[model samples]
Target: MPRGKARTAATARKPRAPNLPAPFVNGTILKDLRKKEWKLGDEVGKGGFGLIYLAAEDVDSPVAQTAEHVIKIEPHSNGPLFCELHFYQRVSKPEMINAWANSRKLKYLGVPKYITHGNHTRGNENFRFLVMPRFGTDLQKIFEGCGKQFSKETVLALGLRMVDALEYLHENGYVHADIKASNILLGFDNKQEQQDQVYLVDYGLVLKYSPDGSHKEYKEDPRKAHDGTIEFTSTDAHKGVAPSRRGDMEILAFCMLQWLCGKLPWEDKLLDKNYVADSKIRYMEDIPALMRACFSKGESHGEISKFLTLILKLGYEEKPDYNKYKTLFKDGLKKLGVKDEWKLHLPVAGTSAKKSVKRKSEEASECSTPKKKVRGTPKVATTSGSLQHTPKPAAKPRQGTPQTARGTPQRARGRGTPQTARGRGTPRTGTPRATASRASIKSPMKGDSVNSPQTIKSPAKVQTVKSPVKSPSKGNNSKPSTRRKVKRSRAKKVDAWVQTSPR
Candidate 1:
């Protein structure tokens, strides 16, 4: 086996993503495209190396509304030309084929459609520009705009699909160095699937497996370059050790943990798990998964902790048998009185082509426009430090507002955006809100928003007369005050239903 990393069994299933020529402004190709009459429109997205724009090129005439395209323009500098041309020239219809393959499904993983690429020149410079379809929203933007959560099932289904995509890439001998919510595209294909399917974007750092079996990998190998964000990076990457499939798994594990728990693994080994494992850290990565690495109140509790435990257990070294998990899910869902819990048939890859899937309640939640208030389990608040200001109500709806618009297939709701500014007006990139505190809902920015109030931020501050609140069973904050009383008079009202649910 090549020393690098083995693509997990999952990634090898799909075709390699096409490597189209990256474009740039003031390039010969841009001039050529200008000659071809491709007019640039608004800026679509940004990358450190290039800028993506929405463009329209007249096929027949400049006046005619032609096809809209996402054009990529790399920054001009002294680097490469022929090598760049060769790589982009190698790009082809694989992207087109990918688009065709996913056109029909409830494709919520928001990836832009691939169009074409070409050479161009302008203002004493020459470079390449590539084109693709356009839909302009990311998970980050969606969370900023909408704080809605998917059903529990939506989170699971979407999580599995993301793993599948990663597996497909790995199988093809490539590793998505950066895997995070911002990198995951949304609102590109289906307006609704933005919340369902997560599009994996920005493959610039992707490591293509070297053909020679001598490529580097994790300690098992030694030459691999560490590439990825420090926050989500794996133990091997941190150690300057080679990378392998486990590296990706570690990153994947980190992403999953962040989704459910709101923080990175805390144990000191989390900082250098592979290094420690190679030394005397007896359990290797096991401790980090259990939060034995570090312990902070925020990182260790709330709903995120609850589900992350389940996911971590799923990743144990001993091959996980999801059958029992599925069984437990079946029973738990049944006990929760989930309706329409039936089997669905899906097309399997090369068999007689039949697979059964269960349709859970969260699917309906995605499509349920008229939403109901869920008296959820207590969670941590993203805005813990600030006192919630009683701002004047605006056009935005409450968390319980029904979403009649159907998002893609059911996904797990453990994931939501945390709109905290790291103290600056500039917001931090999305963080998990599965257990967000109530005080965090201070922001008013608009997004097609995909997150919700499902988080367990602070139970002490958020609940009101309109919605039922679950008191911490044994926290120091609990008191026999009027706030704890469920009953409210006309001067303040209370609900009788509070007596039934497990308060």
Candidate 2:
């Protein structure tokens, strides 16, 4: 074999070691390329190939728990950190983010701003580290805490934010290949003004689709097949095609779907990448079927369905309409009676209470107004009179009953026909008359002169005697009356009430 071929054979024979970096001692200081020193505190977290430490500007005192920055360290041999560092250096500077937000007239953007990064030597081992603004718990943890599902409003709001971030990345000649819940984080400080903000992190898989102001050609490489999270990876990724703007949108769509529905159709078969890919392809062809599979019978989200449909139609090299995508989510939020206030509506990290309580309280306040109005009306008028009698013609002119019931009994009596009919007669003539008429067939009240007119007007009143028997509890007497005229009038009112009450 030639020398080059022998070198390649030897390189292939060597096994690659894992890229986990050794933990650094507390209070350690390191200088970046710019000569700015950062102090490392306790080890806050660890990922597959790196460790995260709370960091602050080099100071005489130790790093505090409230340090506003963090350092991510990985072995020098690791490729992920190297790739991420390059992406951040080239595209995620503070000036870049601020300019984009200002140009777009946005209050804020979700892209994580890169700080300083450099090489570090601990013991005999070399490491690469990057400094970034510290962020709170990621969306994955919140998603799990929320029973693996988010409300429709929250999902749309999050989707809109993600689109804004991805659009910025795309415009900067890069694509975030991995867009999952784990990579999206909320603001670190719990300040009320910033609580609504979220930052997208973990740029290890970031790819530059347009390095020279020209989109990359569509092609597949078998060596890079199935390169992302199986459950949410785009169809092109499964086929080993290079990542593109459309692929990012497709991944985001899957993420939003999972957030809204709690799970994906291919989630159960994630281990089988080929099956997951096939499932996604199958669903993409029929968006309604996909919606039906994820949602319960007779339930569907038009916004989600439309989003998926638009994404499925995108070509491998197509430039996604980011504004169109945002419109779908914004419209969805409106339909859900929500506005894009940037609030996440998720549970706070390390707490049993949910952040969604504020939203729920707002909804409760809105609904409470109508309840107060309902309660202001007389209980008998709303429950017994309006609810039971308003549907009938005979009861149409008795609107004064509910209004009069709110005033003194004297006002109800002074209202004349409607008021006196409801106030005095409701207790005795309304209920007891029906009860007595139904219980005993030989009762003289049936043959009494007071009931003679009701019986003569409609034979239907006789058949409905059993109906009013069910409504005996609705009657309430204010005062006794001995006037034969009042008794006679009460009997006639009772006939109307009994006819209208439900059986």
Candidate 3:
């Protein structure tokens, strides 16, 4: 090597701390990368694999100043951004987005639209960046802003929206391995429809399990189990099995519970994956009780219980009945006598009108009041209040309303549609509770039109391994510390797939 050239190469390398990459300088111009000129702004977020920056088109360019976007950049040498770039090229296409949205009868899909992506060179290093529309805040931040917990109705509404997004992704041959509140962002545009939307972002950990339109065979790969966020990962994830439709629903259920209760049962025991796993088992074993602890007593709680129980019953490889799950939330709204729409309208910014809904307890009489039969056509009484039914035999006396432990009234039926009245009966207040003290705690390749191939970087040091599912405890189980050590030893034998980065 030439002396002068070698010295220049040595000088270009920055002294980086272990595991952290070289930081990208703000205001740095990435030249010839995209059609339009862009200059970087402040760092909006940082993660294990890359940094996210606010980007604006240069002043002299033809674009409007109001058009702001977010750019996610990782080392040009290697990262998951390369994988994501290809996904956006296919899934985020304008026509494809429109098709999915129209099929679902939604104003917009809950996914970030890809703008442009390319690589920028700086001295001896290259950095890859992807530009996407900027969004408001994540559900995590909004949860904090609205107080630690969300109302039961609000949580159900959010769950319904998330299911829509996940269903779209699953149908499109992808699985969102990481499903949590932090990954969900609300839109902030001036358009009302956009403002009412929530998007699932950060596809770095996503996997294309059904690349060719069939779900991959489920096999236990201990190394791959529990490859996502610890607290909300699916049981399949814990077992080192590949994530599927059921896994996504399980994770979403955890998010809903946390949003309602303000914390998860295993939030404090994050370090012990086995403990967390066992706790989750106990949670699923008694879904109704968990719902009671988290959600307020009412139709909302009953509906949420049904939704989760159904999710729990799903097979590891089974396709879910999306409409049935959606109907659970819709039926809850009907029973509560609220609007059929998922979103509750907050009064206009300056208005003093308070938002409220009738409680299930208050609706007891209304639900119990039987309809009177008429011999002739029903009365057409309109403007003025009067009996609507033609006279026949007077209706029987109202039936007694059964109440939940928390005093929420429920409806009873001899038989009804879909048997929706199953869990709304009297609550079992004296059921023995399980042990509440238990603790514990993507993919590859192909194609592409926009993203170019890059070399893989050296693996970063292994951090904590998350449990996707807690194995059911047997007669005598090993201690958590001992079990963790065994898992760690096994992990050392097989290299864990790197998460790469975030959305």
Candidate 4:
């Protein structure tokens, strides 16, 4: 063999070293690119591509376990940390987050603030490290500890905050391709004032959808298909398309669904990427069926259905209406009789509600509701018309019953005895009235009513309605009979509609 061929063969047989950073000793100090020194403490944890260390400013003493900051380190040759470092330097500066929050009139934003990053050398190897504020336990642990299910309130609240975070990233030209429970972290120190806030961390998979003020064209690469967590990844990701704003929202919707419903429909078939993607496509096309598959009959979540429907309609390069998405969550919380206090309530994890940090006078001014700018007359007219039309339909149903009752009796008496037989149909009119009352009572029990009020009322309502005639119950039998009539009528209508509609 020639000398060049022999050399290539020898090199091919050589063993490669793993791409990991060597652990540094406690009390080691390293200076950042800005020449600020940060002292490393004990090794606290490990990441997918690096080691996490408790860190603090270079000081006279040792770094404490309760250090206010952490440093993630990896070998210089590793690409993940370098990519994350650039993301932090470009989009996550402290001033940028503060400015965005102020401009948006928000009390708190969940994007983790970037501190500093620099290169370091130890022995003969070079390493890269980035510093950030320390965070408490990740959401995954709490999710598991809570039996893998979060309350509806918690799910909506988390979703609202995540939307804020993702909006901030998208505005700044980045997409968080990997959003999952493991990447969401509670605020630092786990203090009472900080529990309400959750930071979106781990930007290693972050991509810039828009560069130089132009959105990237939609294209798929077979090599990059199925690029994120299999079960929760967006269908776009499953198809190997580059992550975009819609992809981020789609991933977040899956996360919120899993948090509320405990699992997803395609979770069982996650090993088959194409199957999972196909299932998501089918469900997106028919959100009601998706809700039925996840929830029991008559227990569908309207808010989640609406959210999924809106995001699935987004085009590849289209900007999302962030405020509309927020309204969906806010309305859901309102139906649940709660306000979005920006505090997360994790009952299974035993997290108590706590007041957030006091706002500065400037922040208070920013938080005040802004005056609405008057738009065109047509828009204002449309808004008022919608508001006026909303209550009219509900009121008409109530008002028409009395008029029908009075008019029917006069007509029946004027006609004949056969007409009188139809007039004695007071029971028919009474049944609709009963249904209206029941609907009024049940309207407040939307969203997760199944896990709450329905659980409490189901047995009693079922028993009372089952044997109303045979039981010795007096006036109670009348109410149950009306309810039974309403159920039968509704079932008949549903059967008729289903049979008449196309398959």
Q: What does candidate 2's lDDT look like per residue over 1-503, in tens digits?
A: 00010011111122245578667889999889988888899998887689999999956789988888899999888888999999888888999899999999887899988898999988888899999999887889888876677778788888889999999999888998999999988787642225577888898888899777788887655556677777888877776678988889989999999988888988898866667877887888878888988996656688888888888777777888899988888777777777654766765443432545666898999989997764444443332332232223212222333432322232222221232234434322343333322222212223333332222233444335433422322333333433333435436655665665345
Which scores greater on lDDT, model 1 or model 2?
2
Candidate 2 displacement at residue 222 in angstroms: 2.3
Ranking by lDDT: 4, 2, 3, 1
RMSD of each: 23.8, 16.9, 34.1, 24.4
Model 4 lDDT tens row, 356-415: 123355567666535222211234223221212233333332344443233223222222
Report residue 300 deviation for candidate 4 (angstroms): 3.2
The lDDT per prediction is 0.41, 0.71, 0.59, 0.71
The reply for model 1, stretches above 4 Å from the true place, is 1-37, 59-68, 76-113, 143-154, 189-194, 213-226, 265-284, 287-503
| TM-score for each of the candidates | 0.45, 0.65, 0.61, 0.65
User: Candidate 1 overall Cα lDDT vs. reference?
Assistant: 0.41
Q: Write the per-residue lDDT of candidate 1 for residues 375-410, one digit (tens) a residue.
A: 221221223222122221211323322221111001
Q: After superposition, how far is residue 430 of candidate 2 from its true place, in Å?
A: 64
Model 4 C-alpha lDDT versus the unseen true structure: 0.71
How many collisions per candidate?
72, 0, 16, 0
